[model samples]
Target: MKIKLLRAATAGLFGIVLATAAHAQKSGGVLRVYHNDNPPSASLHEEVTIATLMPFMALFNNLVIYDQTAKQNTDSTIVPDLAESWSWSPDNTVVTFKLRDGVKWHDGKPFTSADVKCTWDTVTGKRDSGWRKNPRKEWYSNLKDVTVQGDRQVSFHLGRPQPSFLGFLAAGFSAVYPCHVPGRDMRTKPIGTGPFKLASFKSNQSISLVRNPDYWKKGRPYLDAIEWRMVPNRATRVLAFSVGEFDLTFSQDISSRLAADIKAKAPQAICELAQFNIQTQLLVNPIAPFDDPRIKKAMMLAIDRKAFVDILSEGQFRIGGVMEAPPEGVWGIGPEQLADVPGFTGDVSKNREEARTILTELGYGPDKPLKIKVLTRNLPIYREPAVLLIDQLKQINIEGELEAVESSVWYNRLLRKDYNVATNSGGSALDDPDVMFYEAYACGSERNYTNYCDKDMQARFDEQSSTIDPVKRKALVNKIDHDLQAAGVRPSIMHQRGNTCWYPYVHGVSPPQNSHYNNWRFEDVWLDK
Candidate 1:
């Protein structure tokens, strides 16, 4: 999973044909896109799903961003966006950035180092006013403070040396917010120094973004405007796309099956399939019955992970522990290593037999089945796997009724810990351990929807985060991955392999390979039509 290896792997996996400048890069067309659901809000800091990132990411600019031209994104590909340049202290505990001059927010407020300090202060809970839900607060847990030296100089002091700190800032979710704008106002009306500005947002209907004429980057954001229409039904959305209603599909929203159908219906479209590194997982609430360790173990043992892969992806997906597996994943363990983890072995019959025995010993059987509702988002990606999970649970006398809710409602339920069992997916913005472990699995993390916590595991998380040596840190990550699955801490079913397709006219775009969160600021996207 070295940088070179990851680049080579992703280059082949992405299968993208970069739009060349052979033809004059014509501008001024509205890039119409199909959104899967109505996003809860436009605030990236408060929401955790791609529902918010897809349409709203263009409205803001990160301090640093992954190279837009690269097919694969790694630490090496990180490039400055708002910041002109940056330097790290000799001890590596403090990093400073020289901000770009002449940058102005859409509201015409001058962008400065104070804005950077205000942004991190809001993110890390230093400011008096805070976001209602800072889902990624843990990403900055190592930061000691943010200080401003002058209008164009900002520094971030860390509690310890974190190698992946810059990569976190490069994430689409890591866009810098303005000092004058509060989090409440940002949820609906946001102002940023990006290539696009929000023109209109109609609840549950559509969002429109117009080009920023005075953007810092000159003559960029080739499209005059971007439009997203909310289409909750997958079949209806695909049908609309095939008939030339939408020019592009939402990032990582199309499945392989849907991609094939689109090609058949609209042969002129371009499609690319790759591992999104987002894992579909099962989360058990810390309520009664599930509070018992035996029940958790039995539930994990009963799950047939391969069945999920075979049925869901037509056997195109890969199975792994908490981290994404092998070549495509930098910190992920190999298949050989994953085989040693519990509930991951090939002997499905033996695993299910043990699961049945455990349930019987706990005084539950087919005659008196244990009934529970399986909660999931009302999207096909989540609903389909949830149905499969329920069928698998029947082997252990666990009767699960699937309860799929809207995207926003489902997330609210997860935050409130209001469900007994749920099937959900966790996507990492970066492939680094610090971003994944801290945000998703660390004790008391806002994104830890399962409410699973272990003091020892948290200590391991810290150890790996601070360790600068790649060799040593990877060993620690591997151990943590194994322990998570062995302890049934939100058992991961499979890593998804999804597709992104667009009409050939939609140019200068390549969906990120390792994550679905980055490379979305469509500054270079121009329609040939």
Candidate 2:
């Protein structure tokens, strides 16, 4: 059965109301939340990491949102947020949105349709013409123009109809902001038409937000305020939660083992377990002997996915292509097709034996070994997996040391292509394969840390992105998934299955299957205590 929305009154299937079986809503308590990190900027137009994005989730709203309260099958559907309703042209090239009339910015400024037009321009890199580092600007490649039609309507002209344009709108990168404020100004102080107003913010520490007194939707945002605390160390955060210092910790902020601790100690807390699209991956840069295809294939054959699932996820994970297996009925390679790929053959012993043979043939049988460092982020969760990867590489005569760097340094090295073989995490907020391919694997894409540039891969990615028909697109997507695995640049480790917890009284929050930071329904969540 689908998890019903705790409150479903203000909006439809997209709305949140007190579900018949859930507790009645209460309106005036402060919700204390524990998070992993603080954002470099609260504005939507910035390099967004899951760590940095968690603390400021309540301060902004996207034009379109993936409905978290919807059933697993329909969860990715585009729903109203700042945009109340919208329509597309007969040719599908133009999308026109009718903005909600009564919405007001946190400063009491009327939120006109022009803000929508300007926000898109900022995200697409039109607002800051020479600034090239907008990490998510590539999401709007199909946009030809955005024009304000009237006081309440705005229209978007696309270069071509992207079948999954809604997926772009639903991304956290698509958070809408006021047209009046300078984009840089928003980095320190943000103002938006969301459920909360930023009361105080300190980078890398904590953020506090108070209820929007005149929030567009009446009688909503059941909590009066929120205090989001950033607890970077995993063990420290678990201790804080156990001592009743926190009300909730979203998925990325907590690991599986810690969740079990919460369930045991804080037995009254509600722990929700689900698999999100986040994946652990092994990205081996093609340098020195790594450039040899045999070495690449051998590296792919070294690890056991089932073991990683047991080690990291506690057996709650799913292993598949670059994308996760679709429990949401989204198009993805089935189990049999997944087994035929290079690294996911379902038999760890057989794959390891073949891997050792390849390494032995290349004159590395442990006496003279292939040594490299597996660079990973300093987080315990990531380091734990990196150590396992080193152990796996040992079976194939590859001696490795675990190198842990801070988050900033870790990402900079990847952008500079300075690492050899690294264990990393990468995935799309959207279920659509086009979103994943364009963001991560497309040639010269900023997120393309592996330096993978192949014309055949590009062609397959492009064909799928442009195909509007679901059936035709699914065929191309499955083919691309197979080719990505067959080429062996980055091998999917496992789709992370972790738990998020909240006090039983923290009602109305239903996290999305993917995009842990995307669908922030904090406005709908309230405290019954």
Candidate 3:
């Protein structure tokens, strides 16, 4: 099944496409789909935020990409995309990348090292960039310089080495932008060398994509077109799925009752894939009462993580820290360590008793209730976990009031550190420990929306970035996780199974372990005849 795509001979290839159309599968086609959120601003730059960016990213290309498969939860599985191959220096601080030749952006311009250099410099080197205010600035701040060798090759010089550099590339934010455009102007129009080209985008309604005829990969994206419709209601999306209106849909609203109903009827229509993502966590804010070790210990004991997972997560298992490391790779914490965390084993009675003892020893009793407001989003899955947590906190004489807020306001309040506790979910940047640790736990990371900061954790995290040695890097990351957990930085309730469903007819479609959203390489997906 090895096929070479020759750009110089595209007409010859088109001749073959015309010749093979009758016998082979149809060429240059499209697929129709739907989503719930409005199309984010038409920006190929890193500034815009929209689920619609997925389709646009697919049309454009990135420096590197995820190896689309099921086991992407751990690092070391990513394959190359724009950069044909790469190498690390002896100390692991410098990364030399060889760019792929003959790749073209959707606008028909050749992709080269210039675009790569521009992309990196815009996101990391700019004096006052869009991401400057983000907490995760630490992740990019360490990048010392980017060296462009030629049109086809480039290298990154780090002030210190970051082992998880590849994981950073795998994120959708790492998608390559055109060199012709300045950083500020790119926020409005995103262009890449991907499989699909943006056809049209109507905010909050629908977005369409057409097959990229000049795409480097051959025999891909079997569908002629793709349509993404933003349908907000979960019930409506499910109904649309049932009626065959969509080939794929994104949902964090997988309910046990819905799973049961699917099992009972239309069994073949539903499929599920869950990953250890931003499940729900009662992040212990490191201010005031929580800053006291005794209070932190009492709260952990008083709260039952098991009941939340069992009753609300619907039997989803809790994971310690973030990495559910798979065996046989460059990085992993292994299954044994994953199972040994205190509240990770799903032992409700034990955890409850432990909480009670800790709180009792701290001079707190059922009569002296510990009051805390639990901030939660209005989404169904989030609300379920919040309600379950509130009920469980009551068992330990903790009065947890559920303060449900709209999604936008909730995020604002979270940034302001308004609540004592809140429920949040975060997926790994496709199998890389660096994505999770750097983006979520890094002391000043933008995504570290929680105000919790540990100097030791931050220093160690920064050290791991530049440390190229595998053993040393792992040790540093593990230490960061250990110290943060001891500080009750954020209590991760469960390593939830990230789930996705598609119609049975949708063949050759698999979800990535890195992100909860639809993966980018949909070029090979075709409806079964």
Q: Quick one: best lDDT, which candidate?
A: 1
Model 1 residue pairs with clashes: none
lDDT of 3 by residue, 353-461 (tens): 8877777776667888788888887666667777887787787778888888765465566667777777765444334556666667766566676665667666666
TM-score of every model versus the real structure: 0.95, 0.91, 0.81
Models, CA RMSD each: 4.2, 4.2, 5.8
Q: Which candidate is the best by TM-score?
A: 1
Model 2 residue 312 lDDT score: 79
Global lDDT scores for all candidate models: 0.84, 0.74, 0.61
Write one digit per residue (lDDT tens) for candidate 1, span 359-429: 89999999999899999989888899999999999988999999999887887898889999999976787
- Model 1 regions lying over 4 Å from their true place: 1-23
List candidate 3 segments past 4 Å from native: 1-30, 36-56, 73-76, 108-110, 127-136, 180-188, 251-257, 288-290, 325-370, 462-476, 513-518
Better of 1 and 3 by lDDT: 1
User: Which TM-score value belongs to model 3?
Assistant: 0.81
Q: Which has the higher TM-score value, candidate number 2 or candidate number 3? A: 2
Weakest 10 consecutive residues of candidate 1 by summed lDDT = 1-10
Could you tell me the lDDT of residue 454 within candidate 2? 90
